[model samples]
Target: MLELRGLGKRYTVHDREVVALADVDLVLKPGSFTVVVGRSGCGKSTLLRLLAGLTLPTTGAIHHNGGRPKVGCVFQEPRLMPWLTVAGNVGFGLVGKVTKAEIEARVEAALALVGLSDFRNAYPDQLSGGMASRVGLARALVLEPELLLLDEPFAALDAFTRRGLQGELTDIWLARRPTVVFVTHDVEEAVLLADEVLHMDGGRIIGRREVPLPRPRDATDREFVALRRAILDDLSGRAGSSPPPA
Candidate 1:
């Protein structure tokens, strides 16, 4: 399990202290999928960055049952090395840490997982936006991390590509149950993918809603519609501290 206790961060900008996160206490069980959703500047990215150890919290602790676990992260953009081929980009994280043959095998598998096997030799410039984003996801998955952190990785994709990748992501999670923490502003995406959806505002997690919906869910399903509506209302200032039960 991974736990955050009183986790907070204060950044100094131009000699003033700005709190990015405040008193965030969370418990994430192994192999669970959770989504953090809120408007921009709500500190969702800050919280994920803290979890990924990209930054340190100013006033709290992060604890895990075992030693530091392997982590993988994907950001809003692909961030691929422009000159590297698809296979090389996927295997970038394993450089010098593993053998050439090992890297080749993992990259091959990851490319296949994300349906990019045929484009192994293509450089970043050759791929479309959606394909490049999948390459980013494959790069992270190649590490086979215990913790996967995604910061709105698909926010830039078109609606069709976004929906397709969402299903693919669900399939990947079911096949390899890593602890996933995804941050996004899309309420529909949150309800569609999260086991638990956390709402944030002004650097704090103010509400949470359990999805408890089955995989390959239907957006038009009554329950799914209701859950999405409740979350939208909550985020739009029409609901209470927590969204009423779905």
Candidate 2:
């Protein structure tokens, strides 16, 4: 499990300190899927960065149940190298730590997992937006991390593509059971994907609501619609009542 104790982050811009995250506390249990939803600049991405140890917090601690866990991340953009093939990008981090054969095996398995085995030899410039995103996901999976972090990984895809990828993500999560934390601004997407949805605003987690509706959820269903409205109201400071625990 991962625990955050009064975790906070701030930055200095032109001599003034700006708070990106403030007094934020959260606990992420193993094998659980949690999604953070908020408007832009609400510190959703910042929280993911802090959890991945890519950045330090200003005034809090992130505690793991045991030793530090292995982390993998897929960012909003696919940060692949222009010179490398899809396979190379997927296995990019394995150099010096594993043999070429091992990297090749892992890369192949990851590509298969993301349904991109046929695109292994293609260059980033040659693939479509969704295909490139798959390459990014494959790269993160190749590391076999215990904790996976995604920052709007599907925000750029077209609606049809986004739905397809979301389904694939759900399938992969159930199979691998990795602790997943996804950050997004889409209310329907958050409610559809996460076991718990957190609302962040003003650099702090303002509310959290558990999504107990059945999996493979339909966005148009009455229960799903109700949850979406409630989350929207909560985020806008109009939810009225405090949400129950997850």
Candidate 3:
């Protein structure tokens, strides 16, 4: 388990103190999938960065059940090395840390998990946007991290590719059961992927909604549509006195 207590971050912008996150508290269960959703600059990415230990928190503390677990991060862009092949990029982090044979085995497995095994020798420039994204995901998965953080990783893909990758992510999560924190601006995407969706606004988590639906959820299903609409209404301050339609 992981817990955040009164977590906050401040930045000096133009010599002015800016609060990116403030007094935020959260708990993530082992292997649970959580998605954070909010508008641009609402501190969604800041929260993710703090969780990833990319930056130090200005206030509060983070506690892990067993020391800090290994972490993997996938950003908005693939950020692949132009000169390296897909397999090389996936095993880049393991160089000198693990034996060459082990690196090859792990990279091969990661590539298979992301369905990019055939592209093992492909360079960054030779792959399409979606394939490059898969390579990014494969690189993270090769580490077999306990905590995985994604920052709008599919935001730049076309709609069709995005949906496909979302399904692939769900599959990977189910298979590996890594604690995942995914950040996104798309409510439907959040609803589709998250076990619990966290609503953030003005540098704070304002609300949360549980999704108890089964896997392979149908977006057109009444319950699915209602939940999506309810989250939107709540975020927009348009929620009715009555609960979402049954």
How far off is residue 52 in model 2, in Å?
Answer: 1.4
TM-score for candidate 3: 0.96
- Candidate 1 global CA lDDT score: 0.93
Q: Mind giving the per-residue lDDT tens digits that candidate 2 earns over 1-246?
A: 899999999999999999999998888899999999999999999999998999998898999977888888999998899999999999998878899999999999999999999989999999999999999998998999899999999999999989999998998999999999999999989998999998898899988999999888999999999999989888777747566574
lDDT for every model? 0.93, 0.92, 0.93
- Kindly report which residue pairs in candidate 2 clash with one another: none
Listed per candidate, the RMSD to the true structure in angstroms reads 1.6, 1.2, 2.2
TM-score of each: 0.97, 0.97, 0.96
lDDT at residue 164 of model 1 (Cα atoms) = 95
Question: How would you encode candidate 3's per-residue C-alpha lDDT over 140-194 as one tens digit per residue?
Answer: 8998999999999999999999999999999999999999999999999999999
Among the numbered candidates, top lDDT falls to: 1
User: Which residue runs of candidate 1 sit more than 4 Å off their true CA positions?
Assistant: 240-246
Native RMSD of candidate 1 (Å): 1.6
Worst 10 residues of 2 by lDDT: 237-246
